[model samples]
Target: MAQVLEFKLPDLGEGLTEAEIVRWLVAVGDVVAVDQPVVEVETAKAMVEVPCPYGGVVTARYGEEGTELPVGAPLLTVAVGGTGGPGPAPAVEQGAGAAAEPTGTAASAESAVSSEYSGNVLVGYGTAGPAARRRRVRQTAPAATPAPVAAPAPAPAPTRQGPVPVISPLVRKLARDGGLDLRRVRGSGPEGLILRADVELALATARDHREPAPAPVAPAPSVAPAGERVPLRGVRGAVADKLSRSRTEIPDATCWVDADATELMAARAAMNAAGGPKISLLALLARICVHALARFPELNSTVDTAAREIVRLPDVHLGFAAQTPRGLVVPVVKDAGRRTAESLTEEFGRLTEAARQSALTPADLTGGTFTLNNYGVFGVDGSTPIINHPEAAMLGVGRIIPKPWVHRGELAARQVVQLSLTFDHRVCDGGTAGGFLRYVADCVEQPAVLLRTV
Candidate 1:
C-alpha cells in the first residue's frame, strides 16, 4: 500500500517564522530522493532551499511561487513505498510528523531510513547540503501534448474536516478580514492545503476585491515628472521597523567632530606598501573605534528599561554598514576587539562581498555592540543617523576630502573627515560621548596616539 507523508517547513533559525516561495525544483509526479531540494524559499534573512524528508514520487505541492508560508506549514506530500514511480521507495517506518527526510539507500529507499548525512538534514526540513546529484525523474509536461484544448476539470469543494490544512496566521487573517469562509474556497496547494492565494481567488470570484473604483477626473496639463515608489519589504522593511523602534524607545544624541585623516591615510599607505595583505581604511577606523570603546565602555552598553539597568557588553561585535542592491545592511564581525587590522580588513572584504551578492546569512546580520557607518561611500559629508536599536551607539564616517589645513603653522592641503557619534542618552552623559569622539579624532590626526594604548 502507498503511504503518504507530509513535510512542513522547518525552522530556518534566527527567530524567522515564514518564507516566500521563490522557485520549485521538482514538479508533481516527479521522483524525489530523501534530502533533495524541492523548493527555493526567501526568508527575510536569506534565500534557502527546503529539502524534502521523504523519498518518493512527489504527490503535491502546497504553495505557488511568491506565496509565503509560515514555519510548520505543509510544503508537500510524498507517496512513499509506492510502485507507481521509477524506483522502489523506502518503507514508512516512522508515523506522520516524524522525519520525512532522506533514507540512506537509493536501491531500497522503502527500507532504509538512516543515512550518514542525516545530521545535515535536521528533523522536518533543514537546509540542503551538497549531496551527490541523482538523475532527475519527471513526468512529461501536458503542454507538450497535441490538441490541448479541453477545459480544465472543476476543482473539488473544500470540506470542513478535522484539520483545516491552513497553517499561516497571515493567511487566516486575510480570510477573516475579507469575511470569506475558509471552507468554500478550493485549495490549489498540494494535499488540499489552503493558501493565501486560494482565499484571495475566492474573494475576487465571490465578492468585490475591495479595490475602489477609479474616480472620474478631467485631463489636466502635465506638471513636473513624478518619482519612483519602492515598496518597503524584506530588508528594507526590517530596517524601517528597527529604526522606528530605536527612535520611539531610545533618547539618542548626536555629536560630531572634524578630524585630520591625512596621517591616517599616510599610515595606511605605509602599511600597504610593506603588507602581506593590504589593510583597508575602514579597518583602521574600526580599530580606532574599538580602542576608543575600551576607554569609554559606557558607550558600548545598552539600557534595559524594564530592569532599569545598563548592560555593558564584554566584547565588541562590530557592525559595518554596507549598501547593497537590496538596500543598506549592517554585517557584524564577531570579537572584533581581539582581531588585528589585517584580520578586520579581510572580514570586511568577505562580508561586503557577501552583502553585494545578497549571500549573507542571518548570523552575519545581527548581534552588534556598535556599528561603523562609512556613509562616505555615498559621497556625503555628514549625517545624523538613527541608531541600530538595542545597541548603545553608532559611528558615522563622512568623506575624507582634501582641504586646506594648518600643518606646523603652514597652510597645507590635507585629508580631513567628519566623524559623528550617535549614542543612547540613557546610557551616558555628554562628557563620556564627547571623550569617545575626541579620542577617535585624535587617532585620525595622530596615528601614533593609538600605539600608546596598544
Candidate 2:
C-alpha cells in the first residue's frame, strides 16, 4: 500500500508566520522528485519556493493560488510507493470535501517513496536550491469510457467531525464573530478544510433566511470622492509598520549641513579611473559613515528599550535604501567597517540587483547597525527620512550639484552636497550627533581627512 504523507508548510526563518501562495508547480497525480520545488510562496520578506521532501505521486494540494496559509498548515499530501504509473486522474467524489485533488495507486508509489525520499525541506540544508525552471511531470487520465452529463447533485450537509480542519485563525475568528457553526459549513478547500469564504457564505445564507429589516432613512449626500484604496500588505505593509513603530517609540532629531563635495568626487573619479573596478559615490559615503561611526560610536548603536540601555555594536552592518517596483527596501551589507570602497561597491551592486529582482533573502535585509539613505538618486536636495526601527541613526545624502563656492580663497563653482544625520535623541545629545555629522562633512570637503583615520 502507498503510504500517504502530509507535508505542512515549513518554518521560514526570521519569525515569519505565514505565506501567500503565488503558484503551484506540481498538481494532483503529478510525480514529484525529492527536494523538488512544488510551490512558490510570497512572505513579507521575499518570494521563495517550498520544496517537497518525498519523491512520489501528489495526492492532493491544500490551498489555491493567492490563498494565505499559516506556517504549520498542511500544504499537500503525497502517496509514496504506489503500484501504478504516476497516480489516478483527478476525480470528484461525494463527501470527499475537495472537488479536484486526485487519488493514488498503492504499489508503484511505495517503491518510489523509498528511493527518492530525502527528508529535507529547507533550501540550503538539503536538495533545495535557488528557484529554477520547474520540471513538469505530465499526468494522463486512465483509459475508460466517460459517463453521460447529468444535472449536478446538491451538496451534502456537512457532518460533525472529530475536529474542524480550519487552519487560519482569521477564518476561525470570522466564523465565531458571525455566530456560524463551523461544523455545518461545507469546506471548498482541499481535504475538507474550512476556509473564510465557506464561513462567509454560511453567514450570508443565514442572513438571507432571516426576516427583512425596515429600510433606513437616507443621509445627506457629501461632495467628497472616494479615493483609490490600495492594501498595504507584504513589503509595503512591513515598511509602514516599521516606520510607524520607529516614529512612535524613538525620540529623534535631525541635523544637516552643506559640504563642498568637489574633493570627494575628485577622489572617487581618480580611484575609478586608475582601478580595475569602479567605485560608487554611495560606497564613498558609506565609507565616510563607517569612519565617523568609529570616532563617535554612539551613532552606531541601538537603544535597547526593554533593558533601558544604549548598546553599541562592534561591527557595522550598513543598510542602504533601495527603491524597487515592490517598494522601498534596505539591503544590509555585513561587516561594512572592514570593507574597502571597491568591496562596498560590489556588495551594494549585488544587493541592489537582488532587491530590484525581488530576490533578496531575509538575512540580506536584517541586522543593520546603521542606515544610509542616498535620496540623491531621486534628484532631490535633502530629506529627513525616518530612522529604520531598532537602529539609532540614519545618514541621508542629497544631490551633488555645481554651485558658487569659495574654494582656496576664490569664488568658484564647486560640487556641493547636503548631508543630514537623524539620530535617536535618547542615545546621545546634540553635541555627539553634531560631531559625527561634522566629521562626515569634513571628509566630503577634504577626502584627506578620511586617509588619516583609514
Candidates in order: C-alpha RMSD to true structure: 7.3, 6.4
**How would you encode candidate 1's per-residue C-alpha lDDT over 1-454 as one tens digit per residue?**
7666666676666666678787777876678777787887767665556666677776556667766677666677677774455543333332222224423442244223223213322233323332322344455422111111122225435557666777667778989998887876666444556666677777765554356776899988889678996555667767888889999999999999998999999999999999599999999999999999999999888888899999999999999888887678899999999999999999999989878765677778878999999999899999998899889999999999999988899999999899999999999999999999999999999999998888
Candidate 2 ranges beyond 4 A from true positions = 1-6, 26-31, 56-64, 74-96, 99-216, 219-227
Model 1 TM-score?
Answer: 0.73
Tens digits of lDDT, candidate 2, 1-454: 6666666676675666678887777777777876777887877777667777667777667667876777655577776666266647434233333223333432233334323323222343212333445345456633222112122224535567789888777788888898888887777555666656567777777776675886887886988889997767677878999999999999999999999999998998899789599999999999999999999998889988889899999999999999998799999999999999989999999999888766777778888999999999999999998999999999999999999999899999999999999999999999999999999999999999887987
Candidate lDDT scores, in order, read: 0.75, 0.77
The TM-scores of all predictions, comma-separated, are 0.73, 0.77
Candidate with top TM-score is 2
Reference-based TM-score, model 2? 0.77
